[model samples]
Target: MQTILGANGQIGEELARYLHNTVTHDIRLVGRRPSAVNKTDELFSADLTDAEATDRAVAGSEIVYLTVGLPMDSAMWEERFPVMMENTIAAVRNHDAKLVFFDNTYMYPQTAAPQVEGKTPFEPRGRKAAVRARIATRLQEEMDAGRVEAVIVRAPEFYGPGKTQGLTNTTVFNRIKKGERPLVPVSADTQRSLIWTPDASRAMGLIGNTPDAYGQTWHLPIDQDRLTYREMIAIASEVTGRKIRFSTIPLAVFTLAGLFNAPAKEASELMPRYGVDNIFDTSKFAAHFPEFETTNYRDGISQLLSP
Candidate 1:
């Protein structure tokens, strides 16, 4: 049986649905309020932050997906994330389950274009990035220790329906919904690698099922077409039949805003990443799953307009 730790969230929900409907696998979902994924065959509510609770929640599972995290701040990571990672590691080990971590690119070296799996300049300055790097490296270390199996898959910026809050919303679709031209922090022309959630979830599932993919990190496969924020706005507007007014907010002002607010502070720090280009190569994943087809940017844009 497969179990998803953060199964109530976007990727988690997609992963659960896929496993339940396609692969004929019995599944368990554990979370802060796993009941959020209610009326299912194997969904349980539990918090991994609590050890005894997590141990009970994770029992009887062969594979577990650690797709959970917090967004409080640097201090939170220094105090909370590691504990969460440690707790999860312990839980998986206790249950003798393999782990598949749904990760992001923040841990990778800062790059202006496509990044390879084993590229250099490993220093990550973002507080959250640093924490993520530590957790990932430790997971790999544990794998080398030969007790548990693990695989990491990193994803870039994502947007679609149901992701209406948090980081992505602050920059993309939310602004458009507010009738404001979204101020993309990156260069107006900086094209970013974006994976639709379903594609990313599928990639994660594929990695979870492949033993060869264990002990390795793979970037989520995408269509690789680069489109500027302006181009994105044009496509979104075209699809929605609503002309999105365009504007650019200077990062300098954002810095000032961050001085008195946590959200703005966290948002501003990520400005550098968005202000540049993030081109990712998913050749490794593609090689294993030749049937994988990433949704095009245009098709994804249209999905955002769907009800």
Candidate 2:
């Protein structure tokens, strides 16, 4: 059976749905609560930071999918991520299960070109980025030592129907729904990579089942064309049949806000992405998973706007 760690998360739920509907029916959800998905067995709850609990949760599973989302604060991430990784790694090693880690693009340094899997260098711009880089290196070290079989599937910032903590939902969608100006983090003209969570989950599923995907890092499928915040706003306006106002939150403003707002404090370090052209190259994933397709912003926006 396939075990989904952090099963209550957005990506975890999406992966569970994909597996239940398209791939396998015998799936076990490991989370802090009961299973909410229709086709999953009973949920296994445990604090992943506890190695014994993690080992218990992962036992008897052939494949373990790690989709954990840590708190946003850099200090919290620094304190929690290593412990979780070590415990999970030990558990997966004990069970000899294949690990599919859902990773983010934060580890990659600022780049003008589309980020390729093996080509991007690890040049962290901030504390959070450094933490990500370290975790990735640790995983690679374990894989190289033949302690575990693992694959890292990375995606850019993700948004979808149910996700509410991201810029799309917290800053854009909610403001537009409430008839307020969307608090855009960057200039409306700057283009960057944004992905749909469902598409990323599907790409992860395909990669997990592919034997050759192990011991390598892969980029998940993202939009072929880069899009600006203005373009996305226009798409949302068209899809929802409502005119939306937008106010770009400048870097200086975010810095000031950071003094009182913890989330904004964490976000200030990410301003480089807003000011630069950030893109991801999924050609490697496409070549490997020929049957998979990415969802464009237009369709993705429509899906998010749907009731």
RMSD (CA, Å), candidate 1 to true, equals: 2.0
Tell me the whole-model lDDT of each prediction, alpha carbons only: 0.76, 0.84
Q: Which ten residues in a row have the lowest lDDT in candidate 2?
A: 33-42
TM-scores of the models, in the given order? 0.92, 0.95
Clashing pairs for model 2 are: none
What is the overall TM-score of model 1 with all chains considered together?
0.92
Runs of candidate 2 with Cα error greater than 4 angstroms are: none
- Per-residue lDDT of candidate 2, residues 157-265 (tens digit): 8777775357667787667766678888867887878878889888888889889889999999988898888998998899878887788888788888889998888
